[model samples]
Target chain A: MSLEVNGHKTYAYTGNHAFDACLPTVIFIHGAANDHSVWALQSRYFAYHGHNVLAVDLPGHGKSAGDALNDVATFADWVKALMDAVGIEQAAIVGHSMGSLIGLETAARYPAIVTRLALVGTAIPMPVTDALLETSAANDHAAYEMINVFAHSPRAQIGGNRLPGAWMMGNSMRLMERSANGVLHADFTACNSYRGGLDAAKKTKCPVLLILGQRDLMTPPRAAKEAAASFSNARTVMLDGTGHSLMSEQPDAVLDALIDFLRPKNVTAA
Target chain B: MPAPKTYQLDTLSLHAGQQPDSEFGARAQPIYFTTSYVFPDTDHAASLFNMERAGHVYSRISNPTNAALEERIAALEGGVGAIATASGQAALHLAIVTLMNAGSHIVASGSLYGGSHNLLAYTLPRFGIETTFVKPRDVDAFRAAIRPETRLLFGETLGNPGLDVLDIPRVSEVAHEAGLPLLVDSTFTTPYLMRPFDLGADLIFHSATKFLGGHGVAIGGLLVDGGKFDWDKSGNFPTLSEPYEGFHGMVFTEESTTAAFLLRARREGIRDFGACMSPINAFQIMQGMETLGPRMQRHMDNTRAVVAFLDKHDAVEQVVYPELPSHPDHELARKLLPNGCGAVFSFELKGGRSAGRKFIESLKVFSHLANVGDAKSLVIHPATTTHYRMDDAALRAAGITEGTVRLSIGIESAEDLLEDLSRALRASQKA
Candidate 1:
């Protein structure tokens, strides 16, 4: 779906369905140098099964026009602007990696607008390695190469992708490759500069879900404990043999966990 | 600077898409012979059919065995995804129909496999889709042939019979300039010789019946999506950028950033056209594909030997192999086909069609067959068979003579192949 935010054209995948405000809303945010299509399966399921899905491509990343935001706060504000533009008073926020940080910040500062939050492949203080930062800052293809190799587990590198025909490694790499020059650098800089993840987790008043991958090298599950502890009411689900690109590597598990969390019959919202 | 880490081609060949059978602990890939899959419940069935989930609904849409081979080929070709079809022609048809409709046009190489030529020149026009043929070497002709209705630019990695190297990088640039995607037939060269995607081609298809299934036991085709083209930005591909009513109003490009072409081809083309690869054929193809790297290397080695032998023979009028310095595209072939040109080549004899018949009848070891890329070396007189209907003028236009003989050198003993060819050539001259 196309919408205007801050007078700039913004592109969001509305699960191929016209957005209906009467239904419960779910906004899916992607990680660094990525776009709305990253949540192709996840967002579609939500849209079909009783929710209005908005998988947004952050400004300047995909079809969205305007300069890319430099930090988590600005991205959160843009998401707010997007929601406001689309008349979504409140919605669930589900994000991955850098997007997870944006979701955390949005829920922390704009709690009224966020109903629930789900973070996938997140770290408390998301730090960019010096090599990666320098490489991306130079707008070098090698930066994407490093991330592609590091993002997946050893098994994913060899390939047993559940989704037919799609090669996980190639698919993930191609998405990141679509980012324009210096856009990837801005995304990494944003992730590296963020300091409010733990604070955001603590400040969040709504129910939270942490979806970590066991073999995710980008944001290893072992490092998620500090942030996970900060949440007053958060559930953790670690997927085995999956990497940072868990949504693509294992679509069903990610969707099932997300669906079950969003419409819990047993566990009420905190 | 660290290099991008990826599995070697040989490694991917043996193990890219298949895992050990979780049910029976079988190491080999098990064929999912069933035509349809049982859904868990109503919701799961709805989700699968509605494109909300990814799994096999029917063998026509996808099959486990076919998908394994598809994934492996996509990996080897550096593509996002691929679709396996009943034959190479089916794969090409699926690709063309998914991107375009009636009244669309294509700019393609004039020197193509006879079957491909038939499809573009004769059959597609019947459906209101037209194609303008351009010389593979003439990049300018490719650009000039593009009309407003042109949706695609296509060529073979190695032009049939002549081994005319289709300058992919140059042709793809021209295609991109015109907002079209370059589709190349990688049947002859395969990924072992070159990856078209790496050279700017947006799409690639293969006759897996050829070198991919090196033993030539089964027939199948693979169409791979390079996943780099921006269909929305291109402003020409409404089939992808706009909502497709045929498949639940799915805008394919919005569904997957990298695999929009693949999604449409599988969902709409394969589902409706019903030209899908059989699991049994997929199994046979995979069994041969497992040793692709080594088999291709041997094929190249043996081909080099046969080309060398034919070049110096007394009965030969001329030999056409890209690696030979005498060939027109030798330098380009050296640059583009660093691994090798291909295993197949054509040579003219001193005598006419009668000589070709005598030569084939005299061969003791080599088989006289219509197919190429077999374990056994095969020969065919193109003038009498493949290009039979073409007049003498048209025959010469395609670089075929009355005595032109096409040879598909195989992984046999180089010495024995030479002896057989030596006898055939001598017999041809005597006739």
Candidate 2:
């Protein structure tokens, strides 16, 4: 479904269902150089199992139209505007990598609107290496190669995807390579420049869940210390043998963690 | 300053998708002949069935042995992923059906394998898909043939029978210009001679029964996706870019940006068509791939020697080997196929139909059969064997004649192959 958010066209996958504002809302945000498709299994499962799923392609990514935001704050604001446009009063926001940071900022800035927050493969003060930032700025293909190799674990280098015949490493490389010319550089810059994670974590009152990949080199589990501590009610779950590309590497584990956290028995249907 | 490069082609062929078998510590891949795997519990079963995890549940959908072959081939071809099928024709069918609907059209080179031609001309149209055949050498003809409904532009790496080298760079540019993908049949050249993705082809398929399976013990096909084509940008492939209702509204392009075509091909094509390859066949193909590097080199070496001898012989009317200056695609072959023009080529006998048969009967070492890419040298008279259904006029249009004899050079001693061909040529003249 396409919606007008902040005067730009934003594309969100509605879980193969027409968008209906009546159900409980869950929004999926993707990492840098990625779109809504990264949430393929997770979002579709939720949509089919009684949830209003909105896997949004951030502005200037995937099918959405606009210049990529230069900082996390603008991305957070766009999510809020998208909710207002779609007529959803409250939602559980889930994000990964750069998206996790967006979820952090959104929950902080608009605490009343964000009922629950789940961050996967996340870290506070997400730092970009000078080498990666510089190469990405130059738009070198090597940057893609480096990230593709590092994002995947040794097991992911071979062939095993939820769908048969899908190569995970190759698929990730191609997705990163497809990012609009200046998009990667902008995304990394935004992550590097943002200094609000500690502040956002303190302001966020909603129940938060942090899903960390034990082998994630991009945003190591150790790096999420500050954000985890600041949250009033935050729980961190660490998964072994998975990397930054946790969604594809250990999909079932990640989904199970999220599903368990998001759907609590105490919370009755609205 | 740069990071060290990963494995090369030789190393990738052996190690790309393989890990030491954990249970028995077997070094080589073991064929998992079982049909279904036991899930750990209810949730585990649900996750795998719901596409939340990556593991083999059913042999028909995926098997460990077949996945190893798929990944190894993808690594060799510089592609994102590959699907193993029952045969080359099945691979082609999966690729076409995944991207197109009933009203879709295709622009293909006229020079194609007889089976491929039959599929495009007669079979696919029966299902409502149409194809326009163009001469491989005519670049403008390809451009002019494109209609708004055209979904793909296709040709062979080395055009079958006539080794017309498809100018991949040029044709792929044309395809991208029209927001379409270029699909090539790389059966003849294999990845050793050419990596179609590197040359601009978006998707490639091979008749593994040939070069990839040098022993010719198994019949299988491999369809590889380069994962470079932008299906969403084209806006023409709804089967990929848009939500598909068949699989609970899964939008393939959203599933994996580069691998969407392959995702649908496996989930929908293999599921509905039921033309999956056997695990044993996949294991055999994997064995063939282990020796692909050395075997292809030997096959090319023998071909050059045989082509040189046939060019100088008195009984030969025309030699259609692309490396020779006399052939039309000689220069293109030099530019595109730097390794070699491939092991298979056709040569004409000065005398007519009876001479062709006499030549085949005269050969002792070369097996007269309907298949190629065998360990033993093989020969076939296309006018009588592959293209017998076509009338004389149709055969002429397809660049075949009664005197044309197709030879698939094997990895044998060059001297032996040359002597055998020499005897056949002399016998043909006398007949």
Candidate 3:
């Protein structure tokens, strides 16, 4: 469904169902060079089961209309505005990689509105290499290829997608290729330049779950230490043989962890 | 900061999509022949149906063996995703139906396979989809034929029988200018000779029964999505962009940035059309693909020797092969098909239709049949067999004559193939 977030039209996949504000909400945010489609399986599952799901296309990234935001804080603000536009009082925010940072910031800034947070393939101070930054700035196709290769594990390149016949590596490359010219450069820069991870971690009040991919080179599991230590009620799960694309590479495991962590203690599926 | 060593085509061909069986540790790809997978509980069933997970539910939608073929072919073609269908005709039909509805039009090349020609000219029109057949060589003619309802531009990589190579880059330019995707049948050339995606084509289909299957034991087709075309930007493909009510109000383009076509093709087209490939067939094709690269090289080597022998033969009036200077698309083929212009090409016999039959009867090695891309050499007289449905003008347009005898060179010894063709030509002269 399309919403008027911050006076610009925002596109969110409603998990293939009509939006219902009556139910508890779950918003799935994708990483850089991607949109709601990255969370295709998870979001659809959540919406169909019990929750109201909103897998969004960030500004200028996909179906949404607007310029790409220059920093992580602005992206967080947009997420809050999206909730308001959709009449969602609070949502359990689930984010991946770059979206993980946005989820952190949103939890920090909007403590009352965020009931819980789940971060997948995340780290404090997510850093981009100088070479990747330079190549991305030049809008070179090599930058896309380099990241795609790095993002996926060697096993993933051989192809066993949970979704049969879906080539994970090839789809990742094409999604990156589909992004607007400055989106990747800006996204990588935002990840590189942001110095607010410690501050956001300190201010965050919601229960947090950190899901790390064991073989993730982009944001190594060890890199989650500082952020994990900051959260008073944080629980961490490390998946075996998984990569940065944890949602696709280990979809069932990721879903199991997220669903177990997010579902209310007393409530069961009716 | 070291880059990982990526596997090459041959290694990927053998191992890309297949994993050792987790249950039995079977080394080769284990064909899962079951009709449906069991769900653990109701929620699991609901989740699987809702696209919450990626595992298969029913064989008609997807099977483990078929998924392996789909991934292997996608890897070989340099495409984002693919779907295996009942046959080459099913693949073509799936690709078209996924993009078009009643009243949609297509601008297609005149030099197409006979079955494809029949589908576009007679079959599809019965359902309100119209097609304008343009000469594959005329780039401008493709652009000129587009109507407001035109959904795609299509051609074969190497034109059937004639061996006229379609200029993918140029035709794709015209298609892109009008915001349409170029869909090509890459059956003749395969990825070994040319990857149409790299050359600017957006979608490709192959008769796996031919080259990819190599042994001609399986009848299956594969449709690959390059994921290059922007359906949202095109504003020409609402079937992809708009919310489809049939499948839970899913706006396919919004579901996956690169894979909307395959998603819809599998979910709706395959589900409703019932033109799904069998897991056994997929397994057979997977075996053929393991040796595709090396087999293609041998096919090319033997094809060159056969073309050469046929060119200078007394009873052969014209040897139509792109590698030959006299062929119209020779230069284009040299540019696009550097590996060779594929194994299949036609030659006109000096003794009309009667001689064509005699040559077929005279050949000891080459089997007389209607199919190409078999490991064993094959021959077909198109005027009476493949192109029998077409009238004289239609035959002329496809570059077929009463004496046109098509040869599909095999990976056999070049000396043997040359000897076989020479003896056949000598017999045709006497007839």
- Which candidate number has the best lDDT? 1
The interface root-mean-square deviations, each candidate in sequence, come to 1.3, 2.5, 2.0
Chain B TM-score for each model? 0.98, 0.98, 0.97
**DockQ score of candidate 1?**
0.75
Ranking by TM-score: 1, 3, 2
TM-score of chain B of 1: 0.98
Question: Per-residue lDDT tens digits of candidate 2, residues B1-431?
Answer: 26426567787777767777879989898888889999999877876776766778888878888888898898889888999999999999999999999999999999899799999999999999999999988988889999999999999998877889999999999999999999999999999999999989999999998999899899999999999998888998999977788887788887676788988998899889978899999999989898888999999999999999988889988899989999888898899999998999999888888898899999999999998887679999987777779888888887899899999999989999999988988898898
Q: For candidate 2, write residues A168-231 as lDDT tens digits.
A: 7767877787788889999999899999999999999888999998988889999998889999
Please give the TM-score for the first chain of candidate 2: 0.96
Put down candidate 3 lDDT per residue, A153-269, tens digits, no spaces: 777879867788988888888888888898999888878887898789888888889999888989999898988998877899999888899988998998998888778662222
Model 1: CA > 4 A from native: A264-270, B388-391
Kindly report which residue stretches of model 3 are placed more than 4 angstroms away from their true locations once superposed: A16-18, A266-270, B1-5, B387-398
**Could you tell me which residue pairs clash in candidate 2?**
none
* DockQ (Cα-based) for each candidate: 0.75, 0.40, 0.62
Candidate 3 clash figure, as a count: 1
Q: Write the per-residue lDDT of candidate 1 for residues A90-120, one digit (tens) a residue.
A: 8899999999999999999898888889999
Alpha-carbon lDDT, every model: 0.90, 0.87, 0.88
Per DockQ, what order, best first?
1, 3, 2
